[model samples]
Target: MSSPEKDEIVVQGIAASQGIAYGQIFLFVRSEVEIPTYQVDPAKRIDEVARFDRALVMTRQQIARIKAEVEKNIGPEEAAIFDAHLMVLEDQALIGETIRAFESTGNNIETCFNLVSQRYIKAFSEIDDEYLRERAGDLRDVTQRVLQNLLGQTENALNRLADQRIVVSHEISPSDSATLDRSATLAIVTDSGSKTSHAVIVARSMKVPAVVGVRNLTQRVKSGDWAIVDGYDGIVILNPTESTLFRYGKVQERKKSFESRLLEANREPAITKDGVSVTLMANIEKADEVGIVKNFFAQGVGLFRTEFLFMNAARMPSEQEQFVAYKSAAAALAPQPVIIRTLDIGGDKPLSLQADLFPKEDNPFMGFRAIRFCLEHQDIFKDQLRAILMASAHGKVRIMYPMISGSEEMARANAVLAECMTELKQRGQPFDENIEVGAMIEIPSAAATIDLLAPDCAFFSIGTNDLIQYLLAIDRVNDRIAHLYEPTHPAVLRTLQHIVEEAHKHGIPVSVCGEMAGDPVFSPLLLGLGVDALSMSPAWIPSVKYLVRAMTMAEARALAAEALTLGSPKEIYARCDAFYRARVKMD
Candidate 1:
């Protein structure tokens, strides 16, 4: 009997990467490994432990090979995805837990390791932050690889693909994504994933279309089935009709043309039609990403998240190590301001190497995180400050603190900076004593008291991501209430206006460095509200720059004025969207 005929199906998911692809589905499934469990005799326990050690060595070598290949095929930034994998391998806490489990229970090494790793995976997966929650996938990937190596199983399904096809899976791990053949893989589709997942990072780096979080997509489609992957709008069409294909071909052409126009406009300065210049900057995680910053024609670095330096390492980076990293970015973008945000760890971004430092909290976001964590751990905070000071000697460098609730927190942070400066001076270190310091206005108290906080700070950067979340009291990652976390809400808009007005009163310029800042739709509204600069991911700069160049400041202000009068978020957003669409011709 033949397989039953299936009708066309359309599935919606999160758009992980932009582009379009139409090809036969290659359902790449890796079944869960069946581990053999057996009791280990006391004498043979040592031998079992030794066997486990060798398996770790083998897993390390395999990951190293994959990392090297990824570095060669893609760029270093994308290859940095594997850095987390290597960190997992070297994690003493995880390794020690596995050993303890085996010694206590006398179970096989595989069972002990599996139990420990699964516990960790569960913890990370339950995290409230999307970026951190995706890390669970990293743990899952490494665990499976180690288990397979111990069982002497070699599965390289992705590498063995003989033809180009749309790769679909339940969840594509970082290791599996790194090994993907760019020439043979048409696009990547997953039943579960997010834009922040390592696999999605690889897909974006490869410029391959990817649609993720399509619930039960793997079960819906099978191998050899035809599908249209619309990564732009996060729609996947199975068994697309000839008419649908024709329509999409034209849509693809239009999208490519629009992207080209955005790039072309990016090469020019971000000046409005009325000759008002806007400072467009990039938010970077690592020093190596300075190349991308310049490539996107950004004026400078707005938010250099220093927590990545800690999160990626097996231990806290020394002052000298951090100095080198900060200096590289400063020097690379010399003459351009590099605003380094001090360690914003805790909550979603936990340091596995120093796990004991942070205790579990019911609500880590508003709990002992960011400025609170730094103030209590003054030693760690001072080291980062000194490094930023040293890097300032090389090029333009400024410091910004995250989650400052009010002036008292700002004063405490500044007092520590003063201590670092005094120590640097005593050591005969040449540094920028007049280096500017800024505070992130994310907390409601900080925003409410901007007038009080502005006097102590040189600048202010509105962290709209957190600000909106706190202002609306909605968990952004929660799908059910995420819609309630609206930036266009009257309260959010009014608060932003108040911040800008107050910051300007004290002669301090304010910039927005959040998801909203990068969006072209919101850029004009922010500028109209008197924001001095916009900082966002480098890739998004082109489109935002294009929008800035397209309209006049007067028009932006008029749009903002109209939006402020609107009663509901839907109405306000509609007005903003119309303003953007009117200025930028998409059709």
Candidate 2:
């Protein structure tokens, strides 16, 4: 009988980062910080509060050091992850609530702070937005550090690894991930995490292979177990057999070769063999990400998510603050258009600052969100428009409104933009008077009525993520029905074609600024459908550009035409996948 060491055990997880690694596992299990709970004497309660303050100060310093190290090692974009952590540290709501909890419960400061922090963590975790929900990890990480400092316990950090090995953990926080030694850390395997988690973001920046949500991976393997991590497929094979190792060795070579090809192609323009040029742009959340946009060779910012500025703040950002942030990205990529999206709050993204304004609803996605929220709250809308307009004076900035259902909504949003332009003029503020306005065609109604709305817009960007979700009536966050949210569904393809056609008829260029735009498999079909541009996460630009450079417009158009005739989404996707695989030469 073969021993357990000879037996191959494979675990499947979500591929958080791309690469391959084979090394001994360094099972990094951090014991939970045990909080001491007891009633504090009335006289010493003030002392407990002071103890909390001291802990906060120490935690802030620790995060600052980590941020500085990350900035030095990785680029400033990755360092911005810690900025959110620092914001959490300085949040008045969290601090005030901790004090209130202590005052009300008369519990030990550690216990009170933990209770208040847990409430905040729970609230964030429950948020429908994936990005916002991932923030719960940041909050949890910060809270644990504060509790540890208050209790005078040192953290179990992965900064000082004995050797290069795969770091296996239940979850790695941004703070812990920041301190990870690149030379000593071979790869990261987490039992719980998502692609959007800050830890995963750090892993990607460090160029380390990472597979997350591996169930109870930590429980199964010892620290010395040898493992093969396939980040491409999100697979981890523990105690791999000789045959399995050989097979994976070949897979690694092919993947590395393909990645090299992608990078080589990324340096070139995204032009088809038929001489048709496609503008490849990036979707950025923060101004700090301008560096990443340039690094990936994205032509411009197709989608600048303004909601992140609000999400990171304790209160609504002032117009001047918003202008400075917008201007930073605009000026950095001067002459390269920065398409600033208006506030897309509601649905999954709710403002903690104005919770009363967005009451819980049965279906928040269709309720008050994006353009509807902006139209109703014109005060907020004008502030953002004014900022975007002001930033345009510094660089090539364009404004786009999200979730426009029809022409009426487009007109209403444009009216607000006009008011901002007028206000800026009265104040003698410099702005691009001809700063173009665009509408996002994410809603099914917007897709159907693009002809009516296109006249009021300078350009159209298809937000396939939400469009597919609404088209299929699928709650993308719902694990049970998420698989039903198919981008290649006949209805989705038809809608996309209709939207592009309608926009073209009105002489407005159309671009896709969604997950579908980045995927190599779907990109050819989109380009074939006559989209003028594609915008996605900066990292994905290279892969999409590679595919574009490999294929001709004639072939892409043929693929799209054939796909339209196919009745099954699987069939359509298979066709697209075949087209991508043939040109990519990964096999």
In terms of TM-score, the best-performing candidate is: 1
Each prediction's RMSD over C-alphas, in Å, is 2.2, 2.2
For model 2, the run of ten residues with the poorest summed lDDT = 1-10
Q: Where does model 1 exceed 4 Å of error?
A: 1-6, 126-129
lDDT of 1 by residue, 401-444 (tens): 99999999999999999999999999999899999999999989
Worst 10 residues of 1 by lDDT: 1-10
lDDT of each: 0.90, 0.89
Indicate the TM-score of model 2. Answer: 0.95
- Candidate 2 error regions (>4 Å): 1-6
Error of 1 at 129 (Å): 4.5
**Per-residue lDDT of 69 in model 1:** 94
Best prediction by lDDT: 1
